[model samples]
Target: MCPPYFSSNTYFSNAIKITTFLAQSYTTMIRATFLSILVLFGVNLLAQNTPYPTRFELSGGTETPTYAEGIAYYQKLDADFKTIKLFTKGPTDSGKPLHLALFSKTRNFDLKKLRAEGKAIFFINNAIHPGEPDGVDASMMLLRDLALHPERYPALDSVVVAIIPFYNIGGALNRSSTSRVDQNGPKEHGFRGNARNYDLNRDFIKADTRNARSFAAIFQELDPDFFIDTHVSNGADYQHVMTFCYTQEDKLGGVLGEFHQKTVLPSLYAHMQAKGFPSTPYVNAWGQTPDKGWTQFPDWPRYSTGYAALFHTIGIMSETHMLKPYEQRVKATYALLEGSLKLLGEKRAQWLALRRQTKAAVATQTDFPITWKVNREKFSETEFLGYEAEYPLSKVSGLKRLQYNHDKPFRKIVPFYDHYEAENVVKKPRFYVIPQAWFNVIDLLKTNQIQMQTIKRDSSIEVTQYKIDNLQTSRNVYEGHFFHNNLEVKAEKQIMAFAAGDVLVPVDQWRNRYIVETLEPKAQDSFFRWNFFDAILQEKGGFSSYHFEEMAAKLLEKSPELRQKLEEKKRSDEKFAQSGDAQLNFIYENSIFAEKEYRRYPIYRVE
Candidate 1:
């Protein structure tokens, strides 16, 4: 067995010096062979020594490390291990820097070089919601073990593991004991909201916070092949401790989606089951127990997994039940990470090939589904273990309230509605033109690495323009916006003039889905819905009723066609006939005096 002193920084520093001298003295081939032999020997010696315990292990898994402690531990590992590297990526809302810890067996940290060598990158994100800190602790232990015992994980040879030690640094810094009331263990945990009181998970697409923007920079840099975001579930009590939320396959679409649904998901479930941690689909059931049945949670582009899918990455969320012990949850999360790495290593070739093929196919694909709905007719039954739900009288309210009877556990077959069909589809355009005025939208597009170029000169091009016809907005605030939905748009061909600095985004690229979803006004999480184009939704100019009444009569007399349409509108719309202002306002709007920019979406599509 290796002595404890051999695992310290001094020992590794001396070892590096010896190896450097040998490499300088020997020939090229001899130096390569000698270095490989020395690396294997050093790793074996390190494996013999016990690894430094993680904060969770030290505390018996009842607590997680603080933001400072977690970063310090990773920094220590970065110093002691040759394969481990820690990088300061960008800033977060907490006024602290976000850190990325990478583990590569080949001692290579360059993502492009690894990709060129056919190595797959597996990314793990932790603590986006600090209340669910299972992944934070699990990742610390997992990475430590990987560094010490390289021989145990053959997958590291073909896969590079990149982990964001603490994603929401602000939330992690905001430690509390009373935030997650329903959670089982963990004596104390971080709050759910970050320093700015924003849920980081919901800010992926909008990127309203610095944390989300930093995540986008890291995500685009690695362009990982597989991704996992760890979380704790809050819902009805169930038998299983671990649950998973995979990116909706139909929304993922094409050969990549098929392979993920048919191959990757089943393998993960089986692997977890073999590891003695039986898992199920995320319990999306609300107002009822999961045994009754539940549909898969829809992960739109605002979510972590959903955002990853836009880049053709297979992403999953490992959600341990909130009712389970924190120790058990951490263990389950660790197992899932291990299983994912193994799967990535074994299927590296096929996964990479499929991703390439999918990107190639999407570049030329014409139609894309922007909206989706669950297909109840196409569901599969799975054996679910859940406790019986009962309505018991509440002592405080003196009314019946829902509660799960843990004593009455049962295993039964339940329908899992995993199939989703495209509710609305849109044809891909040759290019998307964005006027320079909407710089906020353009900035986010560039942040996500969507390729685009500025127009060389002012040009008038015939393009498809969308006029916002009808839409509904939430009466209450949600994520700092009046969320828009049920949108209707009318497209017309017009020769639109674009300025020299206007952005022209070509659709024939690997990020076509992202371009289509965000640029298309009707997509579920489009910028129009998120209020990026809210200025266009309101009319900047309006007619003065007293002055327009006389002008409206002159306009009506000048064009008989306008008069006929006004009469038809009055005959059909009783409200228009009853009000003098309405009649005059209608005429004023139809005249050339009305602003054409009103209710007109600025993004133009070239078909």
Candidate 2:
């Protein structure tokens, strides 16, 4: 039999014949089918029209769309295109829902099912810092082009593009012309902070904002193979319009990292160069010009690319130069996105295999690096096209200020300190036990889709515990946290009793790196450093000098070992011998009078 005709014009005739044969019994069913077909036909007709111009384009790249307008445009695309789908994933700090736009070749929106079918997922995050909206406009054009001209880009067949249209909705809504003082154009743009004035970029690991938690959910759900967080550069200017900060190779650490550094990154740079938009590594030159070499931006877990690296995803931050015209910046970002999508599509098989291998290796890996430092001895040379540095006196201050002489552009090879060595390494534990009291930490872990189990009943488990021996906290608040660093943790084997409902996170999983990095106290962006476990640093109880002095003497008399240690400390240190309170407090502390919870990191490790 011939296939049943569902075309709008043919559907009515076919439906009438069937209804007449069934004597009006099939009237309702035929009407419903006809209406559905008409709706679909209308959508197809709408899709054939000329693509809608974004606010950026309509304004000649002088302005970006408001949060509402950006969403409305995506909604329109969702209505018109069968391959495009828009989903409201979760809530943001702005009281608005976070929207994820998906463009699929098979029209399949299910990410897991698409992965099974061998389609690579490429996630593009835009407007994370609303002040830098290059990615915001570029992604809109990129996704729209993919939907309107699917055949023009054969990459769609093997790659699915997902985009977070406007990440910082609050900031996007809080638009102003004066927010980014350094930015060259875009007459108006969003602010840098969200509604709560939090920099969303640094909240990835801590997840202090609702937007971050929601992002965690979306990121874990997609588990993209290739990711890009778009932004505009804020540092020293150069001839290059676009620059990139890929996840540090040694930190990403594996065959996957090797493939990304040696194969994928070169292809992307070469592709962009061929397209007439020469690129360079992100100019991390702070307080200096590009003539001198600079180190790669170390993307610790707090940043977007760094978070993606924890999952073994190849991630890059496309940073367009802020001094460039808004139009040029947007176009450069668009070109980079196009090049990334094409490369990811072409190398999907090899990339996917590397990711799989990396994940498997992480699961069984023993030692994981928790901290990294740049290897200043090692560097790579790259052609840096930049303006000459000139220390011209400031007109207002009459003081010498470093400035780039844009009139004198030069091309010369500069050393790129792209190599990093692990400064602190940690042995992975079999499992990490988190007390129920630390609900916030546990919630974030769960949000990241880390496999966890709960203790059925109160039980004592022999585990390794960390005592926060020493650490320096930042005097100034950083991203709403008195961030801690220079950590010195002392590990000891002990029997810890965990109550019912306490979380047990295993290390033998795909999220091993994330588990280790966050749980290990020395990790640069660990929860302890973010002040999640700050309560442990303060002693809950203290001894009175007068009352404890007599008790200290008796305790010292009762314990010869304790007495000898106190005597040795006094002999070794003059200050200890002079301060009576210090002697009393030291004796009390070394005795059993001090609180066990004090200075004890709550997260326990199973070896």
Candidate 3:
């Protein structure tokens, strides 16, 4: 690693030597011409050493740097800040390195040491959606600016910043200027899908891609206090160039939730406003005017912020409007991040205190909200800057379509219903017993860094087991997983046997929220709800209606209670009385021969 200020000092030294040599060796006119050319080249070289001066600008704004160029820029900066260390997180689906840059004055990459020194970790992720390359360029500039003038920004002293220069490596490599139709002038940028064609954003909870797996490892290792994933937004046209999505506090839960809603978010926005970048919540509403208002964007676990919230880390999805000029978007992204650093630096102690409190509190939290309902009764009114939305006829499609009329822009107060009420809150169990057979769920839990132990020997324990009563599946393929939801489960208290090596996860830990949200059947993104246990919803065995008809009749004849029930059902329902198949199916479901394990969710909980 190069020592701090080595690049700057060396550049100046080289320039002076070149100038002196040129003046002595050539005539005045020739020397002046040579000196001017040499000076221009020297400045360009120094600018390269400095950050944010992109190759695109060097080329007179005709091109953006390739993914390799972005990585190389960071690597070069690594030399300027000796404390800055670059490491390959791992190879992506495209066999390219996922590089991370960690910076600190002490050159300490040890997170524990940094924490001991009263430093917090601020993790910034860029290029998740390669088309939204604003952060990629912005982060390079931010880190360079901080390193070049460490004394100028006191906030740099409060935290150790780690940045993933380009998260979706494959997407970043698939370059195209036309991919983002609505986006303004980057000249060229990456596509949104990775090599495997997976959207890494949606693969967080599922971990379907190598990128997500690597991210999981990094996230667990750092356990950052604050995180930001940068992007560009596509929504109703608005005056605000930058907007953001923080993890919904109501879903994050406990004091952590309160702190995020009441403190961090407001501070960041306020800071942004002070910087003149006037901010707004992410425009989650589509095909609607902002003046009509919208709700907070739901940051589910699949999203970066949502995953970060599982561990009670403050995470924000920073989005620059795609309609804005690329340079303006990049600058806006840099400004938002710069403001965030200031706020974080000013409130470092409070953030660290809240971090400790929340981590400790979550371990013992009794009730974890698995689902949330919008609290329509409570809302905050914010000024919304937007163009009038109009439905205009499409000349090609011969239909009216929703669009923004930029000719009629207006700013007005609009309701931002940010409040939410918890629904289907679950009383957390002491330990969750997952059968060893369900290794899929076990692997995922482990991937999320939830601690678990294996049963030393075969044992029987009384626990509550969820029987999946009903489930719904989407007709469309989502992120390569058959998504499921609307889970209806019947919990039964019973003694269950587990084999040696069965997974035992104690819920009283920092990952309690993650545990409950995933293990519980009703949670919006539970394993059951995500179709991890969809097999349980299928019955493998069933008696033929013709063969079981005689048995059902005999059973009804033998048992007076069965006979009465059958007679009552027939009398009450004309459909059942007329349909022999329906009667036989009902009898089969009520029979002992019906598969007991069908629709039986394997995860059991011990109180």
Write down the RMSD of all candidates, one decimal each.
7.8, 8.8, 4.3
What lDDT does the true structure give each of the candidates?
Answer: 0.87, 0.87, 0.80
Off by over 4 Å in 2: 1-50
Better of 1 and 3 by lDDT: 1
lDDT of 1 by residue, 550-596 (tens): 88889988999999999999999999899898888788778999889
Judging by TM-score, tell me the better candidate of 1 and 3: 1
Residue 492's lDDT within candidate 2 is 96
Clashes of 3: 1
lDDT of 2 by residue, 514-567 (tens): 999998989988988999998888888898887887888899889999999999
Model 2 residue 569 distance off true place after TM-score fit, in angstroms: 1.2
How displaced is residue 453 in candidate 2, in Å?
A: 1.6
Model 1 CA deviation exceeding 4 Å by range: 1-50
